[model samples]
Target: MTACDQARELQRIIDQQLISTMFQPIVDCQKGTVLGYEVLSRGPSDSPLHGAPALFQAGEQCKQVISLEQACLLEAGQSCIRHGVSHLVFVNVSPGLLLPKAFAEDRLQSLLATNGLKPENVVIELSERYPADNPEALKARLTALKKRGFRIAIDDLGTGYSGLKLWSEIQPDFVKIDRHFIRDVDRDLVKKEFVRSVINLCERLGCRLIAEGVETVAELTLLRSMGIHLIQGFLLGRPNPFPTAELSALDNPDPIGGGQATSDAGYLGRYIVPLAPTASLGEAWQVLQSSPSIFALPVVDNDRPLGLLHKWRVMEVFSSTYGRALNETKPVSSLTAYDALVVEHDESLEAVSQSLLEDDLHYLKQHFIVTRNGHYIGLGSTRSLLRMMTRSRVEQARHANPLTQLPGNVLIQQEAVHRLQQNNPFTCIYFDIDHFKPFNDLLGYSKGDEVILSLARQLCTVFNGDSEWVGHIGGDDFVVFSDRLEIRKRCEEVQQLFALEAATRYPEAIRQAGFITGEDRDGLPRQFPLVALSAGIVVADSRAFGSAADLAATAAVAKSKAKKAVSGIQIVSNIAALNEMSDDHKTTLLA
Candidate 1:
């Protein structure tokens, strides 16, 4: 169809109000409740201009966009009322329609009033499809809407060219991240960082962030962990013509960051306070004076942190002749140290400390900002970080095994107990040197110590990235535990690596014979095989074990069976299965 025909079609849809409104829920992930719905308008399904993009394009060409948008707003409000949706309704509005004079007297407000919808119940989602004709005019209109109790949201943030600048100017009450950023946030570190940074920025700016287009459980979980409570996506609930304002339940939801325990090496959430970016230097001075203990304050706009304001720096600025008069009235954000150290609340305290130390020494005096997602949670002093590190080192020393430096019995038990509560599938492999005591006596304790250290390093290297735990249960006994499916392959690799290392470490005569003559107890000389590995693996069943101790006992039984076998590898399904295996099969090992 020609542009003219498409224009006529758009006009008819607008005049007759034939647009279809689909209500997609915006959920509060943490609370597990539906916060509101985003009103998405569709043109007549039978028409060529059915999708939002096509219809808007047609309207754009025909100079009827304002009319089309107004019509959608009217219909969306009525549709919400008809559907009994009492929550906040978000409607997309083009940037072109944001002129101050036009919005001050626009029929959009009147249409909402007719449907019994107040400005507070409506959220004007400023679309980024078209650039603003006049930014100042748009800001003026948005400011007026805000004053009238209407909530403003900047839509498709991060994907748009002018989103940051627009955010800085208008400081919307909410910001919707574009689908591109949220598409695979769970798997993409870059996207995670981007979203995290956006979240922080939103917190500093005092703006609510809504993740758009969340399509997977991983994505939803990651967003929730990052402190993003408001989410909209197909994974939660798809947009429908008739939608209910009810949150769908998520299964087995993990805490933020997968319940990964925080090391004592990170900053806490005690020092964070909300300071406006537009606050005057005088206001900043008053804040610093009131809170004499804090070294810095995080400067923010709309709960999204911009940077930090150091008390010393501010005082230094004001100490200069005429400095107070020259800059007192200026926004505190203008003087904020944008490069001040900013770290997530979950970041390793050591990592944050190292970054500060490695950076220009000047930043040491500037207190670091601690944020959850991107919003300012508090300020962490360099002194506090150093203190935490000292305590962490002491704790590490207490938990680490002396021989191999791996975690000892206490920490190992703690790790096992934590996994038991999670109830995820996992395998635990318990292994020990086959003839460690005899070898230790024959080769002297020094050589035996080397072998134990070598095995520890091998275990750590093999299971390093699987989120698995390697622990020394003391003596020659060590365990490799993981929920990864490849644990079987890793166990084999460990056995093979130890075999090769053992062969290489022996003298020429011992290497050739694969055995050594050593004096056994009672002064009797005997032939003993070279050092070998014995591993017993248990694939846990949630139904079988009530405690970590029960699981450990079952794994010990499996280990004993593996030790008796000449080849030294035994895998059992569970504690019950370990008892059921025949004597011959239980002793059999992987080739």
Candidate 2:
């Protein structure tokens, strides 16, 4: 369409309120739940301005950007209400539209009220895409919005002009890292460092940081390891008119901290009745006085958790001569400890422990509230958390491999059994170093240990995802468990990486010669090829195998076949056919 036609179409879109809103979930990776949904506006599919860029560009050209944004905001609110979305709704707004003259505060409030939404439940996300001419004025306007109970977020952080300056001045409650920084973050060291700095800054500023546009599990895994809990991306979910509050992609059986079954904090929580936010201080004091064991009482409104009320704080007020009479009738919410750490029940114990260590010492002596999907569940004590941490550390040390510090055979067996019980299709890879004994004999045991550790590191780097696990079966033998279907390609990458890494450990001449002179088991001289990797891959497609031992036996057969292959990789897809092979045939195959 021509420029004039585009402007007319844009005007018609704004006038008729033809804009449609699609909601994309922003997930809390640690909790494996959706924290909120960001509202995305798009023009009608049949129009030339169907995409956001074309629609907004036309608005800017026609000088109807403010009107277009207003329509989008109203449509988003209506959609949210219609969909009965109770979680936070993040609506994008241009920086220019945040000005008092461009968008009136009363009108904004009226829009929220009309949709049956509260200011606290709606986040006004201002994109740094449009830099403000007068930041001080914008800051003043944002302050006014904050005072009115609206949360502010800066979108596309680090990509627009004056990102850090705007972040410092506004001090938004949330900041979303642009997609540029999130894409291939696992491979790019500079992007990783930049994100790490952003994470630290957000923590120090007491602001929530979200990593946007996570398209791959590698990026998701790396971001989660860096302490980024909130994430948004096409990998998790796509934008839709109606989106589910929970994402199955985030439901990782083995999360970043560890396995979810043992690492979740919900197991540590004890049931403690919560105090209503409307309860008076006098009533709260009575509750605390009656229950001397309760150190902190959760303040809950409906099913939602507001904050916590410490017994000590409440007692101090009541102890004073005039304090009781002056504040006894006030609501308990007035004394709510907003800063108390509130964690989701599914949050890993390791993550919760990190949060505690980062906070003041006072938290060490008190209790933290636990919630499930933002609803009050129970209270968890620091004493219990510390005790659990100690036990976990002891168990891990007992089961971990000494050389590489990876999981040992006992844990490896348990992991295999767990995957089998889950009955999900997965790949079990057994990795063996070819001619490792000869290499150790020629290059000493200490140098041999270096190769093992290097191989362990490579396995970790290549299989670093939520569903991937690497374990050491002792010596130069390691095993990998992964849910990815593309195990063959990943195995190829591992072989290529190990080949390069193994070459570095050999002498210059030995490397070029492609062989090392070493004594054979018969005490005779032989030519051993420089260390190479041999991988045995078994794709488990069903519950045909009863136990880990049975699977291990099949994997052993596969390994024997791999050792005799030229490519050093063998895959066994049919367990029944492999089992039917005679012992003599297997021996011949290995030979």
The alpha-carbon lDDT assigned to residue 212 of candidate 2 equals: 93
Report the Cα RMSD per candidate: 14.4, 19.1
**Candidate 2 overall lDDT versus native:** 0.82
Expressed as tens digits, the lDDT of each residue in 1-591 for candidate 2 is: 998899889988988989999999999988788889999999999999999999998999888888898899888888889899989989898877877585778788776655588999989888877888888888898888888999999999888887788788878999999999998765444576689889989988889999999975557766876799899999788898896644765643222224333456764566667888889999988888887878888888887878888988988888888999999999998899988788887686878898888878654646787788887777788888887778667766788899999988767776776577567898999999999998888889999999999999999999998779999999999999999866888888999999999899888999989999888989999999988899999887556676676678778778878989999999986576457678776566433
Give me the runs in candidate 2 sitting further than 4 Å from their true place: 1-261, 325-329, 357-365, 417-427, 507-509, 517-526, 538-546, 571-591
Q: Per-prediction TM-score, please?
A: 0.48, 0.49
Give the alpha carbon lDDT tens digit for every residue of 1-591 in model 1.
Answer: 987788778888988889999999898877778888998989999999899889887887888877888888788888888888888888898877667365653466786655578889889998664688788778888888788888999999876567888899988999999999998554444566688789889989999999999875556766776799998988778888987543544653332222233232222334446678888999888888897777788887776778888788889889999999998999888788888777776566667877888878654544776666786656667776676567656765687899887877766765665567567778888988886766777677888888888999999998886358899998889987788745667787899999898677678888898788887777798888888899999887466676676677778778988989866878877668546556665455210
Candidate 2 TM-score, true structure as reference: 0.49
